[model samples]
Target: MDDKKIVRAWIAYDWANSAFATTIMAAVMPIYFISVAGGTDGSWSFTQTAAAIVVALLSPLLGAIADHSGKKVLFLRVFTVIGAAASVGLAFVGPGDMWLASIIVVIGMVGFGAGNTFYDALLNDITSPEQREKVSSLGYAMGYLGGGLLLAVNLGMILGWESLGLPDKTAASQISFVSVGIWWFVFSLPLFKKIKDPQSTNKSRIGEHLKIGVQRLGETFSRLKKYPELLKFMVAYWFFFDGINTIIVMAASYGTTIGIEETDLITALLITQFIGFPATMLFGKLADRLGSKKMLYSSLVTYLIIVLLGYFMTSSLHFYLLACLVGLVQGGSQATSRAIFSKLIPPGKTAEFNGFLSFTSRFFSFGGPLVFGLVKLISDSSRIALLAVAFFFLMGILLLTFVNLAKGEKEAVQP
Candidate 1:
């Protein structure tokens, strides 16, 4: 495939999967889990924490195997199928099915997280170094647009179900799950068709590959001291990205706790999605001109402000304002982090290193939401929990200051 086609196919996967992120993770499913399943806010957080731990344990092994076998695309397809299938299964869940719902959600989230490790590794295969920031940003921008578009239609279905001939809001929400699954599968075709695999000489049998993957993962950990800058960046990413993930996953539930209406919460999320599309693209251009690290720092500072805003939020309007603020920096921060990490990975080890990236991000990510839930449980205030998340951003900023991007890039280029 041509470079243009490959890049577009790669970006298309973001569009394909982000429906899951927006609909299942951020908007619809959390509310459904609460209203229909009788789950509390802490239960939602715990569900994500449980799923994150499972993915964190498996990603490195799977990533290393894919790298060794040169089957990254195969792994991507397998996990995407798992996620989409589970998403479809969610539509069948009914009232008081919390256990079933939680199990399906965990399966779906594991797929999403695991599939993303390979998708991110593909950045190294598909784009030149100079083009990575823009390409990565474009993927995220497309994600915002795709997710927002579906959420808008889903929102209409929920709000106007009577006119649409649906039975009730619950039925409408269930149908939205099926829509996201279909959207994910249909949009994923382009990437499956267009993106070619990177060539590799290591063609071991499955059993051998598993053993080798474990060995390689162990070696990578033992050699971490040699890549100090990359290690620092990963630690920094783990801290702030945990806070970011917690916010994305917990925002809807938190809104419910604070008396924000469901419609308003979904509307605020939709607004964030649309705003994020263009804002992410703008950040891409800015990163190209100003450097990824500088843009990342700016985003961290904005996140700190957003966390502070979340602490004081009371009305739906305040929720909307905070959502907009999150939109401004969320994609920028994540996209630049991916682009920067791409520059640091060792040659022929993109998937393996990305697995470690996923592992660190996910393992440490268990902290933010777990802490948030604990704080909420102890203090009986989601407000205090929001305030507690600010510490993550602050710690991330401090760790980021110590990372030498130049040194990391230099290490990556060495033979």
Candidate 2:
């Protein structure tokens, strides 16, 4: 395949499906979670945290299975369909039916999270050894652009529901969830059409997939001793990503808690999506020139600054500024991390390794939301809750120093 064409299609995957993240998950859902759940109380945050844990626990196991089975594209499609259906179903949940809405959000989020197992696995298939950074960044850039684009349309749908025949605020809000299905399904069709699934060598039975997935997972973990650098990288990615994930999952929630209106949160998140677009492009080129480690360090420094600033942000403007700062580094840091890991994963185990990797990410993700909720419970301060994330980042950065990026690169290219 021509590099340009594949890369374009790869990036399009980001563009097409990212609206699910920008509008449904990041922007609108926090408000919906609050409004539909009846309150923004500590209890609601706790429930959100609980959902995170459930997904976290299951996500890696699923990823491991996908990797061993080489079902990246297939799994991505399955989860996308599930998530899309649930999202549309949310449109039917009346505001008075808050409990039903929460259940639906959890189902949709889990499906979304589960599908990512395969999405991340596709990294190796789409990009060559030499182009992972650039390719990864392109994906993120597309996501930012795609996410922002959908949010704009979603915003219109949200604000002009009267003309659209929505009966009330709850109905209008429900439409946002419905848009997630429409947008995700419509955009996702392209990838299913264009991208090829990595062919699995594992021709085992369904029972065998489960058995081998479990067996190989243990083998991979045991390989940590022989491959300490890869293990270290996994640990590093997990810790820093935990902090990063916390910010992503909680940014809007914290903003709303701090008196920023729903619209302001939407605008701020839009900044994250669009700003993230070019930043990813820039980071990709820079990583190609400077090495992934150096580029990643720069990203962490930016994240540290953003989180530190969050400690003192007082108003919606402060939230806006924080969102911009986050947007600048968010996609770059994350996409680069994926690229770096792709360079280290054991070859032929793209799905399995990526699955294990994603599992760790999901597990840590569970912690962040749950911990943020706990912090909010104890302190009632959004800033205080967010500050704790910095600690996770610090731990990751420290572990990163022990991992040899060059060795990972060499190993990743092995047949």
- Tell me, by TM-score, which candidate is best: 1
Q: Where is model 2 more than 4 Å wrong at Cα?
A: 1-3, 37-47, 163-165, 198-203, 366-385, 412-415
* lDDT of candidate 2 over 72-167, digit per residue (tens): 788888888988898898878755666776777778877777776678778788777788888889889988998898888778877887888877
Stretches of model 1 off by over 4 angstroms after superposition: 38-42, 199-203, 373-381
lDDT tens digits by residue: candidate 1, 1-415:
2299889999999999999998898788988999997787778867987898999999999998988899999999999999999999999889999889999999999999999999999999999989999999999999999999998898789879999988999999999999999999999999999986757786678999999999999988986777889899999988999889888867877888899997788788888999999999999999999999899999999988988888888899999998898899999889999999999888888999999989988777778888998998999989999889888989999999999999998987777
Give lDDT: candidate 2, residue 131: 84
- When summed lDDT is taken over every stretch of 10 residues in candidate 2, the lowest stretch is 39-48
Q: Give all candidates' CA lDDT scores.
A: 0.90, 0.78
The C-alpha TM-scores of every prediction are 0.94, 0.90
> Native-vs-model 1 lDDT?
0.90
* lDDT, candidate 2, at 141: 91
